[model samples]
Every structure is written in C-alpha cells, then in structure tokens.
Target chain A: MDNKLSEICKQLDQLALDILKLCEEQVKCRVKLEEAMKPGFVHIAKSRYIMGNRTVCSLQLPTEDSAEFDALTTVVPQESITDSEHRGFKLVETPKGQDTSGKSVLRRRKEKPESDASTEAKEENVKTYVDPIKWFGVLVPQNLKMAQNCFQSVLPLVVECANVQGELQRVQMKYQKLLKEKELLS
Target chain B: MAIHSAIKGKLISVIGDEDTCVGFLLGGVGEINKNRQPNFLVVDKHTSVGEIEECFKRFVKRDDIDIILINQNIAEMVRHCIESHTQPIPAVLEIPSKDHPYDASKDSILRRAKGMFNPEDMK
Candidate 1:
C-alpha cells in the first residue's frame, strides 16, 4: 500500500513538471505568433476579401501510434490479489528510444478493395497535396506567409500539449484512487 | 464505412475571432467535409453564445476533428460547455487572441493541472 502511494506521488510530480514545460512552450509560441501577425494586420485589414468564406485545407487525422503508444490502460497484476478483487492499472506509453516523430504522424492513404477506375480516382484525390496559401490570392504579403509558418511549427507543440494534459488527468485520477484506498486501509 | 474513416487522418478545427481564424486557416488546418460543412468558424461580436456552444458541440461530435482551438476570450464565454467535454481524442486548446493575452489561471486544462500540486512542489 505504501509503495503504491509513493509511486502515485512520484507520477504526480512528473506530470506537474510536464504541464509547466508545456505552459512555457505555449508562451513562446504566442510570442512568435504575435510577431508574425504584427506586420500583416494593416494589409489584411485593407484586403478583407483575402479572408475567404471557404476553407481550402483538407482533413487528415494523424494515424494512431502502435500498441505501445496507445493510451489504453492495463491492469498490473499483483501476486497477493485474487482475480475478483480490484487491482491497480497503469497507462502505458512508449518507452525510451521509441519516441514518435511528430512529422510522421500524418495519416497514410487508406487501403481499400475497389474497381480499377474507382481506385485510381480515390488515389488521385488523396495523393495530391495542395498548398493552402493558394486559397488566398497569389502574391500575398510576406507577413501572412510568416504567420502560416509560425502556426505550422506550433502544430506539433499543440499535439504534445494535449497528450500531456490527457496523461496528467489519468495520473491524477489514479492518485485520487490510491488516496482513497490508503484512507480505507488506515 | 467504418473501415474507410478509420484509415483516414483527422482534422484540427478552430473557433476564434477573425484574425485568429484567418491566421490558422492560412496555416492549412481548414477543411470542408463531404457534408459541405467547413471546419472553422470566425466569431465576432455578432456571434451569439448559443451559436458558439452549438458549434463547439458539433465539433466535439465530429469524428474527423482531432483538435479544437478556440480564442481564450471566446472560450471564457463558453467555459461550461468546454469543461463538460472530457474526451481525449478531440483536444480543446484555448489559445491567445490578438486582443487578449493567454492567461494560465483562466485556462481549463492548465488550471486543473495547477490545482493538482502546490506551487512550492512545482519548483
């Protein structure tokens, strides 16, 4: 019981640190974004039509990581506990040396069995990657491009922040459960 | 049908003021699904709280969206709706707008995390 409580405490401490780092990164990203925006506002304000009514970007959800990085919870069996009794569970993450490359998180083409004509058409639609800036008129100002770059770079950070927040929540729930159990035992 | 969508990637949606929407959309996270629904909403003073809540709820229910970015000040108005969502897939990130700076204390996820530990221990 004591060991379990201490483990929970340690996990909480690590998650606290992760949140702090994420917050700092967010601040930095905001600064870069504002810098990118500062030079463009005057131009963008004048040409309001550049803010088109429709979006040209396509949706491509990142593929889930393999089983190891999957956020699924698994019960960690304790020898002393019977199968019917409640047992502790832990959320597994990729161990060291198996870090996921954020760039590679983009979804791969879907595999499907179809006629030759349909397959070719689907492949054409999926394979073509259009530059989103083209949605705006050609020869947009440099600041708008800079803002786009800033947002693209910050995309990975946003994903990382979300992952950390989810993990923190999971760990916090576990910590609360252990606290309850410790009280019952005492 | 399930197999088709399962293999496809997800999208990042945005609900923010005009500047924030235009900036991120320019970054290429925008999309209009098969249903002719655009993935973003550009909020202004004319936008109602009810409309914002509805858009947020729609985004939460969509299978394609992986992330939802809302301007922090706009999120302040719809705090209850954002807090009610607990799913891990469609992450709700409150971002800074041109007019309002990011406030950690007002952020739902950040504040929850801050509450978990004492300030001294974090150091």
Candidate 2:
C-alpha cells in the first residue's frame, strides 16, 4: 500500500511541474498576443472591416494519439504566379511547433472521389482558398500580421495544456483510489 | 470519429468577446461550414448567459471542431455546461480575454488538479 502511494505521489509531483511549465508558456503567449494586438487597434480598428464570416485555413487535426498538433494551414491562391488551367488550392503544412527545421511541407490531402466523371468535375473538386488576412483589408498593416503570428503560436501550447490537464486528472483519480485502499488495508 | 478521416482538417472554434474572436480569426482559425454555420461566437454586453450556453453546446456537438477556445470570463458564465463535458475530444480551453486576464484559480481543469495536492503532503 505504501509503495503504491509513493508511486502516485511521484506522478502527482511530475504533473504539478508540467502544469507550472504550461502556465508559464501560456503567460508568455498571452503577452505576445497582447503585444501583437497593439498594432491592430491603430491600423484596423473598424469593427466592420475586421469582421468576416469565412475561414480560409483549417487545422490539420491530429489523427492518432501520438500525432503532433498542427497550426492552422492556409492555402494561398497561385492565380497571379501561375495561369495554369488547374487552379486547385495547394495545401502546404507550415513548419511550427515540433518542426524545428523550418521547412514548409507542400502536401495535399486526398480529395474524396467524385461520382460523376466529367471534365468540369475536376473544377468542382477544387476549393477556392482565400487568404484570411484579406478579410481585414487589401493593404493590412504589419500589426495584423503580428497578431496572427502570436495567435498561431498559441495553438500548440493550448493542445499541450489540454493533454497535461488530462494526465493530471487521471493521476488524481489513481491517487484517490490508492488512498481509499490504504485506509481499508489498515 | 471515422468520419474524421474523410474530412480535410478540423477547426478550432472560438467563443469570446469581440476582440478575442477578431484577434484569433485574424490568425485564420475561423470557418463557416457548407451549412452556413460559423465556428465562432462573438459575445458582447448584450450577449446573455443562455446564448453563450447555447453556442457552447452547439460547438460541443460539432464533429469538425477539435478545440473550443473560450474566454475565461465567458467560460465562467457557462461553468456548469463546461463541467458536464467529460470527453477528451473537442477540448474546452478557457483563455484570457483582453478585458479579463486569466485566473488559474477559476479554471475548471486547473482547479480540479490543484485539489489533488494537499498542503499536509508538502510538509
């Protein structure tokens, strides 16, 4: 009983440390976010201009338990760069969080096969990707970009916080169970 | 959950004051589905507790939403609803808004974790 209790105690201690570290990260992210927003207030204070109904980027959800969380990946239109007949939005995964090498991976997700096979069917499969930043204005100030970067950085941190919180909850339950067993044994 | 495979990617939904939504949306986390349903809710002084609860419940029900980032103050307003959520998927994260800073003492998950530590044990 004493051995089990000690083990639970160790786990609890580790979790406590992890939570503290996560809190520190959260604070730093919050500060950065606040700093990032400072510029937006001066440049894009018009509530109507900033408000938009659509999102151009989507988070690549973790598929497996061990999968690394990803930041929102936005597909930029290559209309100006290329006049290619096939105007499919290229999905590029930005290098953030664990991707320390800082190389953006140009990868595309497999699209669902269409039922009707027509030449126009190819166009139907293509999604028009709009840059979310454009929602603000054509000529947005650098502050808006900074705010986006700050918020983008917070995604992985939020995921880590959630994972640690889950672990702490599990260990807390185990500790409680062990305590009950120890009392009964005594 | 199997449907997650067919979908391209998941979304991080937001439920907070106007500033929080605007800031994060600029980060490119906002999305309106084919159903014309937005993944975020902008709460103002006119926004009621019931409205917040309703939007939160809606976010919880959304399969495409993997994370819900709500302002800590708004989360407190809907604490009962937040507590009832037990699933690990679609994590409900209480973040600090510009107006109200984050208070760890009021966080549901952090508060529960804190309870596990007894002062006597430290000694």
Candidate 3:
C-alpha cells in the first residue's frame, strides 16, 4: 500500500509538470501567430505621429508646422514630385503640350478643358515651388501587431489560469476533506 | 486590442462588488478603485452614481487617466457628466451591472452601430 501511494504521488507530480509545459507551449504558439498578424504602424493623424517599433512623427519632412503645411497642399507639388527628376531640387518646367516621359504619361493622357489653361498654369506653379524639407518615418507592422496581440493573448491565459487555480483549490479542499474522513474512521 | 501601453504600469483601478468589477480585475487588465486615485476607474452596482461622478470628474482632470468603466445603471444617474466629458483621456464606458441587463440602447457599441446603419433615422 505504501509503494502504491508513492507511485501515485509521483504520477500526480509528473502530470502537473506536463500540464504546465503544455500551457506554456500553447502560449508560445499563440504568440507566434499573433506576431505575424501585427500592423506595420498605427498612424495617429490627430497626434501627427506614427506609433510602431518606435514613436515617430508621421510627416516625411520634419517641420514645425508640418501638419498645417501638408494640409495646404491639396494638389501634388511639382518640386516634391520625385520620379527621375533634377536629383536634388532643380527647377524644371511643367511639360505643357505633351509629356513623353512614362512617369507623367498617365497625367498627360487625361483630357483637360481648353478653358482651364490658366487654372492648369496656376497648379503647375504650385507644384514647381520648392519647400526643400520632408518629414517621414519607418513603421514596423510587426511591432504594432505584437502590441495588439499582447493584449488579446492575455485574456485566454487569464481565464485558463483562473480555471486551473480554482481546480487546484478544489483539489486541495477535497484532499483535506479525505484526510479528515480518514482521521474520523481511524 | 491595442497593447494599452499607456495604462499598463499606471493603475486602472475598479471600484464596487465582486461580480461587477472582479471579471476585469481578474483578467489583469484594468485597475481596481481602492479609494486611491486610479488612472482608470471601473464602478459597479454597489458604487453610488454620485461617488462615481465625483471620481470621474477627478479622473477627467488628471492627465494620467485614459479610460473609465462604469456600470450602465450607475451611469444613467450621472448622464450629464458622461455627455460633458470632451477630453480624449478618461473615455467613459457604460458596462452592464450585475443585477441590470446590458441595454443596447444605452451601450456605446449599439449606439455607434445604430448611427452607422441608420444615420437618417437619427435626424
């Protein structure tokens, strides 16, 4: 009887260890899956910041009034447009008649009203004007996803931990009850 | 499911009875209101509306608080406070109380969905 009781105790200890290991493995697997799904960056327009691997200002060209400046340019500025242009800020005339360049081919293809020449010239002027500075930041989708998953993954673990804790409490209580019963019988 | 990095170390304490606040507290998410000024507060059925409102006012004033979770029943009493808080931090959430059922009409989720689906009806 003593040998059998010792064997059962060893088996129970092994089972507990296995359960804990399994729980850890499950958490690890879930974390890997969650890491793959994270977004590159959380762009907060209100804060004018991109939060990802690190917090960075969303503006490509860093400027004091970047938000306000970006807001002003509804049309794509010509100076800012980088294709195969004048490498480091060069004044280039807007192709007025027909642009052979593949980069501007799509824009040139669009039909414009003959009456809108003045408007077109005005737009071109706005594009050609150079402001020289750009603010931008690299956003890591993995970091964003990892952050999100961190919160989501906690819920199940918490529930499982609670359940296991409750079970352990019940098991202890039952063991105590059985010991009392044995005492009473003896 | 943002990582809630802002509120992680800071206390997001909950106040009230076992049934109402325990679930969130046990989940290891929000802080429990233990009479101390918490970054986030969760008020339950046992917590009075006046107490909740007073705490909420304090929470809104504090820069640290990011969110507040209050029992929907208790929130009904302090509707003015809930409506008036324009600050981004200390966003008030009306959750279901233990005794009272979660009413879709009062809940923000349902309200937002309704607004999205039937915007014209709202007018």
Candidate 4:
C-alpha cells in the first residue's frame, strides 16, 4: 500500500510538471503576439490628410497633436509638393541637409530647352514648397485587431499556467508533509 | 512568457562558447514555435558579431521578427550597431552565458527598475 501511494504521488508530480510546462508555453505564445502588435500603438499619433481618393493618415511621433506637426516635417520623406489650391503639384526631391522651419524655401532648377512639341513639355512648372508629410504613421486597423485578439487568446493560457503553479506548490507542501510523517513513523 | 513571444520567429544569434549555447538549448527555452508560425532561430556561439549585426539590421526591417536575444558579452562588441537601430521591432535582449551568470548589478533592466522603485537606495 505504501509503495502504491508513492507511485501515485510520483505520477501526480509528473502531471503537475507537465501542466506547468503547458502553461509556460501558452504564456510565451501570448507574449510574442503582444510584441507583434506593438506597432498598432502608432494610431495614438495619427494625423489625416485627404487629397481626392488618397486619404493619408500620418502618425506624429513624440506626441500626436497637430502642434507637433512642424517637428515631423524634418523626419518624413519628401516625395511631392502640394499647392494651396490643391493644383499644380509637382514631384521633386527635397534638398539634403535643408532645414524645414520658419519660412518655406523654394529652389527651382533652370528651365530646360524644349526641342519638340510634346504634351508633357507643355505642362506648367510651378515652384512651390509645401512641408513634407509623413505617410507611414497611420494606425493599421488590422494590426490593432490582431493585437487585441492575441491579448485575449493569451488570458486562458496565463490562467492555466497559474493553476499549474498553484498545484505544484500544493504538491510540494504535501510531499514535505509525507516525508515528515514517514520520518516520525520510522 | 513575454520574453518568449517577443523572440518568436526571430533569430537569437549568440556569439559565445559551445557550452553556453548548449545549456540554453537544453533548457528548451529558445526558438519556440506557435500556431503555424515559423520557429524562432537561435544562432549558436560559433557566429560572429558582424554576421549577427547584419542579420539584426535585416531582421528589424522585416515584420516577421519581433525580438532578438544575444549574449551580453557578444552584444558589447557591437554596441553601436545595437544602439543605432531605429526600428522598434526586434527588441534586443541581453542574456548571460554559461561562463558569466547574470549579474543584477550590471543588468540595465534591473537598474532601471531599481531606480523607479527605490530611487534613494540607488545612491
């Protein structure tokens, strides 16, 4: 009977360890999902600009307020210029090391000589300097949803891990008690 | 658990002795796979810092990798590369090796936590 009890206790200990391992595994999975979802926080810094069908949302760093917009102009890549009338926009690369502050600076290259009559050649050249807008900052809704799902999915696993840890503690206490009893009996 | 997922599908490129890498491998702690996601990579001690840094630069650019685990000793060698990374992805975690056990006094996380909880005690 004593031998049978010892075997049963051993089995219980193994079961507890297995449960603990499973719980740990679940917790790990949850954490990884959380890390992947971190970029979704960029939504907190979102800025939106709409031009026809192109609705651009920008995430301003440090803070999301429009007040911080000036600071972001330096950081964002300059791809194109937009005019106040929302027309005559031209694609030009911003000069390197040029500071974007106070008055806007405009440097237009000398007009090239046109040899042949082409529709592209007839286009007007307007020198306008608009602040470079940061385009990548928009909070991706899909990423945010995925992050939420990951957080929810990990909750059960965390509970299981806790339960297993609790069971292990109980078994450890019982094992100690049994050892003491055996010592007294001997 | 947070540590595990932060490193999932990400490569943990280590540069140290064989024993240290083996110890971690035996512990079954690195490179956990989940829900059809690709298994995280663990570069053993044999890899070089340059190779690791190059991989790190590329890894951070990718959406797949979230965390990077490196032996602290090896990380120290390429501190500039590690510090200069702009992307928040592939968060770098420095771990102790078999030869060098983790010293709380030297760990930045512990130092930061201590500063937050017991500001006076730090002095």
Local accuracy of candidate 3 as per-residue lDDT tens digits, B1-123: 122211122223333333334233322333212233233344434657778778778766755443455666777777788667543333454444445644646744234323432333112
lDDT of 4: 0.36
Considering the two chains of model 1, state its CAPRI-style docking category. incorrect
User: Where does model 4 sit among the CAPRI classes?
Assistant: incorrect
Ranking by lDDT: 2, 1, 3, 4
Give the alpha carbon lDDT tens digit for every residue of A1-186 in model 1.
787766656665665556567656655655554555554444444444464433221222111221112111111212224455322222221222322323224434444465598766764454223344554656765645766666655555555555555555555565556555645644
Q: What is the alpha-carbon interface RMSD for each candidate?
A: 11.9, 10.3, 21.6, 20.8
User: What are the runs in model 2 whose C-alpha is more than 4 Å off?
Assistant: A1-125, A180-186, B1-7, B118-123
Model 3 residue runs over 4 Å out of place are A1-186, B1-17, B30-47, B108-123
User: Residue A36's C-alpha lDDT in candidate 3?
Assistant: 28
Location of the lowest summed lDDT over 10 successive residues in candidate 3 chain B: B1-10
Best by DockQ: 2
lDDT of 3 by residue, A1-186 (tens): 666555554544454444444444434433443332122111122122334322422122222322221111111111225463211111112223222223244556877667488887764433211221112223433433343334334333322322332333334334445444433543
Tens-place lDDT digits, model 4, residues B1-123: 343222222232223333333222221222222222211233454667777677556556655443444555666666677667533333455555434544435433323323332333112
Docking quality level of the chain pair in candidate 2 = acceptable
**TM-score for each model:** 0.63, 0.63, 0.31, 0.27
Q: Local distance difference test, per candidate?
A: 0.58, 0.59, 0.38, 0.36
Question: In candidate 1, residue A170 scores what lDDT?
Answer: 54
lDDT (Cα) of model 2: 0.59
Docking quality (DockQ) for each candidate: 0.21, 0.27, 0.03, 0.02
